[model samples]
Target: MTIRRILIANRGEIAVRIVRTCQRLGIVTVLAASEADLDSQAARLADQTICIGPPKSSASYLSVDAVVGAALAAKVDAIHPGYGFLSENQRLAQACSAVGIIFIGPTEAQLDAVGDKLKARSHALAAGLPVVPGGEVDSVEDARALAEKTGWPILIKAVSGGGGRGMKLVHEPDQLAATIELAMAEAHASFGDPRVYLERYVASGRHVEVQVLGDGENVIHLGTRDCSIQRRYQKLVEEAPAPNLRDGLRADMHCAAITFAKHLEYRGLGTVELLVDCERDTFYFLEMNARIQVEHPVTEAICGLDLVAEQIAVAEGKPLRLTQDDVHLTGHAIECRINAEDWTQDFRPSPGTVSRAVFPLGEGVRVDTHIQTGARVPPFYDSLLAKLIVHGTDRTQALERLRHALAQCVISGVSTNLPMHVELMQQEEFARGGVNTAYFPWFLENRATALRDQRVAKGN
Candidate 1:
């Protein structure tokens, strides 16, 4: 069954991105926007728009009832919950199935399996994928015991958490019990799940993930992406294919991801995130994102595939059309998330209006954005203003293109992290490629020290 119309239950750049794909596929788009996003770029681009609820996510984007109800009312053949919000939600998938509307993602069971951190780890181990040493901690005593066994500097993570909301790093034994309690409370408040787990922290870990597309029976990987440049576990820069892996490591990672996806008989687009311990020269399964990722453009640039189109086709009950051998990866691509935040002020959200937004356009450059001149930067949603992606013949060429693109980007009215991207491009370690996850924090510290030294020299 072909999907004639799709209800995009999302907003911002991702929503716009989906709309563009649907348009190209000759599928009508119905945007289920909140009151705040009534005039959003997606709303303008879509064939039709329907108000789901108020600006608050609970009443709108996060509301399964609102989303499914809008899909029912719009008479759309499917609902695409673009990444974040309810993209990985099982209830939305179930509700869509109950209503005879397709959910453009993995099955409900798959979501449940991967949504819980512990369950995902179990599945990874079953699929012969190595995982970090850790286990579930149900109580303060349980956490303390696990901490003792896992050694110092362990991570206290919420079982149902992502984006670093309910994660705590405990460096010493004295911080174990209290940190566990705090993490549990924070997890409860954030994800409505109080369950927390423990994991041994790898000090020199790099964030790498494999992009896979499966149609229930067959799975094929697009390649790998290195998202090690992050702040507080939130990725800011991503590149493909992952640079500087030990011999045979990249192929092994791709195979592991495919094996895990096949074990689940996964359908639709997913990302198998892994933590590469640079010191150990090995990788461990982190978790799976059961929806299209924000950094997917880098993969698209290298593979020349529209991931959203593939997702819709899978939802339409289509089998895998492209085999692993059919997929050819070329060149290198890098993406910098341009967010409406003040990097100097602790990355505080700067929501107001985009008075002027000018993005670079030329060979080897692409910008995916919903914001334009005079657009309102609403405070209720993610602060991402655009994604600046560049591709070239190789990593060096990609880095050069990214540097020029960053230099050409201009956005005013709301303070953005453009300056941060510009400086990051010039950093020798980053330019050299294959920096670990801790590299960003180290860069920040060095930057601060340099500023202090400059101030002292200037007699300020």
Candidate 2:
């Protein structure tokens, strides 16, 4: 139960992040890597490595049996499914329990409670939290009926989906049935679940979330994060202590998150996502992610906590060490997800051997990456290459530091979104902050229009 050794059932930057924490905690790390990732940075940093399967995630990272079997073979005391892959998987948690190995996350029941979008909504409502108006639809007729009640421009969402996959927007009644079928097919293909639900789309909403840790009986929130800068509903930039909130709004969000976590008697680390409708000046519960998030470093930066260490300690059944009063948030922190993608080419994935990799280093700057010169950027996995994080005394300083940091970053031999990040940091609206979820798409459209105008001016 002390977790002397941990099997890291993930790869890339997150795997490396877990390894660093395990090392600092004096815990030996065993990496459950795919054949394609055996030579990865995490594999190199880990005390030992085992090939779980081939390059495909289905045969490797996503396979509960493969991950647990590798943990058994390695004799690790626990398994850390960092962030993605099987991080939110209830079966993996149950499998760890059956094997007498600790899963550094929420319980199987908690996963079941929050894994389905509709179930999560019910729980949130039960916790006295407001939720978007919507319900599950079994057929096209059901969807149409719900859409009629929810009004036009409803969002069709998969029950078992995240990261924007299996989500569709319907702007009118004519697109209902076909959109329903298309959404169902996509949901089934992406999440192995055809079940979909509808929600009234908040036209001017900001994506915000609060980080909470619990020991099943006691819970405390670590403040809020703004993740509104996104493309296709996938966050590209995140900041801690979500900027431009009205007075008491941050405290309200934190309290709501704690209320929901206590209602579930939740344990371990989780993020309670919410949609803040700027026009209405109100917030609604979105869902709870029962695992570490990619943007966790921003919270860690401001709170001065090693979230991974705290997570492991909680898994060891240790009670909460810090009280709400003891926890202090001192500064602003920002994180940019640097991915191996050609943003100019519609964010196409770029996979190749890295010829050069350079990141900024200074006070208040942190770069979490698994890439190095000569490293292979595999096409089979998530395009994420690194997370660039920076901290400052306030939002302005953080933005300034982030701009300089983005300027210093350089990744070659594969197309990366570094250029896009640089431009985003300089955008006037982004600099002002508190942009809505639609802002990023609008930025893209505006950029395209500017490019066209530039082409015409060149011809003239």
Candidate 3:
């Protein structure tokens, strides 16, 4: 089952990342690109490239038939779906199999196991892991009744969702009915599934996840990552070996993640996300991503492992290269998702041609990006332009290293969230590792209010 050649059914930094790994492994790569990405970094790096369709993602990246057709036409041994678009689409995996091509991520059954949040919660609970106070509801009344038991400040989420698309937070009983109705409508439009569920909302919780690898037999964890810094439910910053995690609690969380992955027979690279109530020193299963996550570089920095290469090896039917006993974690790594968005405009997408792109340079600094001078930032895709990662021997060192690197980064002609990252690094709470999922949005609002007060005081 050796993979001689593979087609990347994706585009972006992730696609380029896969190309580099394939090149290092001496495997030929065929990049499947939309018309807008024909001149992308991934296209240039691939040994061969094919135009799948127009720039519209629906006709190109999301088209299972188009991706499979390209793979079959090229006679590739496998197709790698990089992190987004069709990455977790079980239909894409099935299509690949139907065309006699290997899909390098999870199998259809495995995808089904954790694809839906509600079902994933059940799976985690069955694996001896705890879950939040939540359950699927049939109607608004059902959600209202569950919320009453879960207490006020309940979260209503779409059963089939990610990135907080169909999620609503209801703080009082009077808001339940309207919130549930709106959430259901949003869910139906977003995922074509109107089902909703209610869960207890944690007042202060840290978003933590474990990096895991499975070979259809056993699963091993790389370590934990703290992704507490977020905005609009999107991760803005991530750090490996979560800082300030309680000693025994950290061990328990790791054990739970490993158990959950093994119970599902997870294959390839996946992330088991959890929400930890830091005050209570307890955690609950959130969801599982059955593909390489965007924040994987932090795990790689600390463990000194190439996750993508391991994914390919596993797809070739090779056992995991390292066992759990071999895992030796050291140092602290932090990653900033440098997106092409204007912080002044609520992180609105800044899609345009880059006049200059200069990232940081030096030891312990890594820039995973595809944009360069004159590169067009397509409007049809995610705003993520690059990932700025830094590593050091400890959390303090890593924080300082990241701060220095963010200051040095200079990507002109496109408004980015770099200012926000720079500002966050200087905050006392963030420096003390006291950040949680709500910290970023709160910081932004407070910062704006302070600026307005300053202007008023100056009689502007």
Candidate 4:
């Protein structure tokens, strides 16, 4: 079905991004905002906007019935669910199908198959893809034996967990049972599911993911993104064309991702996250995100493909205009997630009015944001305020561009993580691309002096 008008079941910059894409395609955009987001940037950008429900997500974005009702009321042909909130909800996908609205994403069966980490691992391994060495143990004794087999320092992760929640790292067998029970309880609270599984943790490994676009039959890999720079499993910065890979690693990674995607006959834009163990020179499938990622612009910068536009075309039953060989990646792109949080206070959410807002802008710089001067940062949702992206000829040039952009970014009236980002880009380890999952904790501990020195230099 052709998408004449799309109802966006999201808010913030993602919603605005979708609206801009639809507008470019000469399609009307219908934005559904909650009571708190009526005056938000997305609400202002949409061709038409409606207040769906109250401030809480349970009554607004997460309410499938309310969202479908809003879409029907606006007479939209499709619904674009930007990442987060209800993006991965299988019930929402089915509900959209039931209402005869183009969901603009993968099928409900696909969502359910991959929504749970354990199930996704089973499917991926069966499809001849290398998955993390772990799976569900039906009993506590079984988990202990598996831990013994997998060795110490295993991760007990929730099957339906996202955003780093419901995860616990246990280093010894003695602590396994308690951690398992704790992880299960956390999982139950977070996702309303109590199932937990174990995985052999990869220390000093990088988090790299391949971006794939598929329309049920044709699947193509759009290069890779390095999302290793994260804290508490939430990425703070991401870059396209991951810094380094051994001989033919990129091709191998791309092939594995495509194989996995095609095996499932997936649709739309999704990312296959993998944990790359540099020490062993091997990669393991981590998880799949069945939605447009927040770091998509970085890939677009290098590949020069508008993923959101492709999503719209695929929803309209159009075959992919470009093939795998057609995707030509050029230059390096980096993105820093600007959040309304104070890094010094353990990254606690800090919401307030934006007293001053000055974004970096020039050649090779792109800022996707929903905040403006004097705008009040709502405490009801994610603290993500903006995304500062930049492109350059290579990693060095990209770092140079990121340094300039970070220096130019300014946000006042709230304690933001701008200082940490600035410190991160200036550090020698980051500059040399020597990073992995353990990098953040190391940086937070040992880089304090370097950060202070950089701050002093900048002040001078």
The local distance difference test score of each candidate is 0.95, 0.94, 0.91, 0.90
Give the alpha carbon lDDT tens digit for every residue of 145-264 in model 3.
888887879998898888888899899888888888998899999788988888899979999999999998989999999999987688989999899988898999889989998999
Which stretches in model 4 have alpha-carbon errors above 4 Å?
448-460
Q: Sort by lDDT, best first: what order?
A: 1, 2, 3, 4
lDDT of 4 by residue, 326-440 (tens): 9999999999999999998789999889999999888899999998888888899999999999999998998898999999999999889999999888888888884898998
Badly placed stretches (over 4 Å) of model 2 are: none
lDDT of 3 at 420: 88
Question: Compared with the true structure, what per-residue lDDT tens digits does model 2 show for residues 156-223?
Answer: 99999998988999999898888888989999998999999999999999999999999999999998
Please state the error at residue 378 of candidate 1 in Å: 0.7
* Model 1 per-residue lDDT tens digits across residues 1-460: 9999999999999999999999999999999999999999999999999999999999999999999999999999999999999999999999999989999999999999999999999999999999999999778888888878888799989999999988999998888878888999999999999999999999999999999999999999999999999998899999999998875999999999999999999999999999998888899999999999999999999999999999998988999989999999999999999999999998999999998999999999999999999999999988999999999999999999999989999999999999999999999999889999899999999999999999999996
Model 2, residue pairs in steric clash: none
The model with the greatest lDDT is 1
Worst 10 contiguous positions by lDDT, candidate 3: 139-148
State every prediction's TM-score relative to the real structure.
0.99, 0.99, 0.98, 0.96
